[model samples]
Target: MFRATTATIHTLCMLALAGCQPSSDGRDHGQMQLDACVAEACTTLNLDGYGMRDYNAVAGLAHVTSLMVSYTDFADLSELAAMSQLRELHMGMTEVTDLDGLAAFPNLEVLHAQYLEPQSFAPVAGLARLRELAVGSAGLDDLSFVAQMPALHRLLVVNSVQGLDLSPLAGHPGLRALDLRASDGMDLRPLLTLPNLQEVALSRIGEDIDPTQAQVVAQLRARGVSVDLDAIVVPVC
Candidate 1:
């Protein structure tokens, strides 16, 4: 009978373990693609359809300008802190819950935050350079953040925010277009205070508009603003 030495057994065990482990090169296909994108300095990166949750590789992409991460499983925006050059970010249909990392991008211009219900929109309050914001179906109720954004001209809030409050939008300096489907009983007096308001498309979610709201709409139209109030149906005589 041949006696196996301890060294021989240890060597055999090591080889077996090495064989069991997956090769690092083939382990992560997404990481490899991301690495290639970073190497090429690709400005636009679309991470949709990857079903990826880990964003560690995204930190290396410093030159990415337009990033579309819809359909991803990422819950936070921390990994994108290094991407300060990002201008347009489309984050629709994602699981992202927090936007604290958005503070890093000071030059962000366009933001499409549709279909995501963030805990708070406070992080966006500091984005002074953000111009276009589309928040359709985001279930946002608070418009206080918009008051701080002086450059915001276009705001789209369709199919969200029941019993909406327009007090926050009062006295907006550059607000030109407003499109929203708000529930009935919303205060429409705030629309009169916007200095540059040029267009409005309001659709009520409930029955006939109140007399006060109708009067407000009439006043807005009287001011040369193109107002479309199809939902404001007065009771038939």
Candidate 2:
């Protein structure tokens, strides 16, 4: 009887071991498959127009680290919420109006949304780790939201905006680079107050800028700010 009991226990152990063995087919995990699909799409995608079909094809695979959907015809990008591991997201020339889902990406660092509207950036304020942001040619009328980004380093607000006061940007101590090209009729006084500012691109000056402001720009250049006046077409008389 003792021998029989020992044999039964040994047989059960062998069965358990067999069950634990890996499958010979070597199928990948669901998440890994998703990641691969996203990586492949990001590498080969073109940003010509709305890409709802393309995005829908790979929406199920959402483990991508970097996603670029530039110049696509996508109107609603809410499906991007699945990409939790996304680090860099570039959606230039898309019609996406809402970015509320961007907050889900905790590791998001760089975001480039050029040619978009100001309202499109409202959702990115919640991204805690955001570092670099470029929203050139987005027709932004307000920059109050930038003050909320504590980790922001580089900012580009060039072209397509009017009547914007950059005083709020003074709170951003980590900001290094700023681009305000083509912003005609804007005052440069508020921009001069940034404490850690290093690089500034001022293009398309309006009648508002005067010789005094030019002197201020010279002072900023003396203090290590690389100010570019190449875009200043007509001097303020």
Candidate 3:
């Protein structure tokens, strides 16, 4: 288990001074954005949309409540353990493996990974306060870790739906949003019984959902649960 030290303060300063450098917002900004990301004192760090080839700024961030690093190639998260105040962390395509760095943020409430095929949540199982989790890929066959998340309310499993088995979610009542990009035909009936699942968004279906499966999703929506039946790709098979 990692603990705070003087180094934590230095890292926090780095994050605060992130804007002292200068850079553009991705879509238009590149390393130039992060390079200019040095500030004096700030809490929320919005590094989203930057093609992050380096993350030296993490060391100087402390007391941060929300940090968005989504849509970048950031791999190293060793500096995260120091941001004890961190609550929301968004990462994408960074090709990360270990999550020990995240264990330090006991206050983490939301964790978003653009693609989960390359990451693991096993290390963060101790995050008792996690309320929302989003993964861009559903490549993993074992998501039992989800059940371990007692405070989880929103979950987004995007990209591939290969080998998905959501049976473990049978009794999950706290989840309010369930977003899936594709599911060969994973029976969503189990979700209907969830007491608090308020919204279900099935976006970007790779193959057409069979009629029976489509009806199952429809039923969940008809039962007063919100559903984003976005362009069902192809008609029901």
Number of the predicted model whose TM-score against the real structure is largest: 3
Cα lDDT tens digits for candidate 2, 58-127: 4554545666665555556666666677788777666777777676678889887766764556677787
- Which candidate, 1 or 2, has the higher lDDT? 1
Candidate 1 lands at a TM-score of 0.71
lDDT of 1: 0.70
Off by over 4 Å in 2: 1-52, 118-120, 136-139, 205-209, 231-237
All candidates' lDDT scores? 0.70, 0.61, 0.63
Looking at model 1, residue 70 earns an lDDT score of 59
Q: TM-scores, in order shown?
A: 0.71, 0.70, 0.75
Question: Candidate 1 has which clashing residue pairs, if any?
Answer: none
TM-score of structure candidate 2: 0.70
lDDT of 1 by residue, 86-160 (tens): 898877656777888889888899886756788877788788888777664546778888999999988766445
Clashes of each: 0, 6, 25
Those runs of model 1 whose alpha carbons end farther than 4 Å from true positions after fitting are: 1-42, 48-53, 136-139, 159-161, 204-210, 230-237
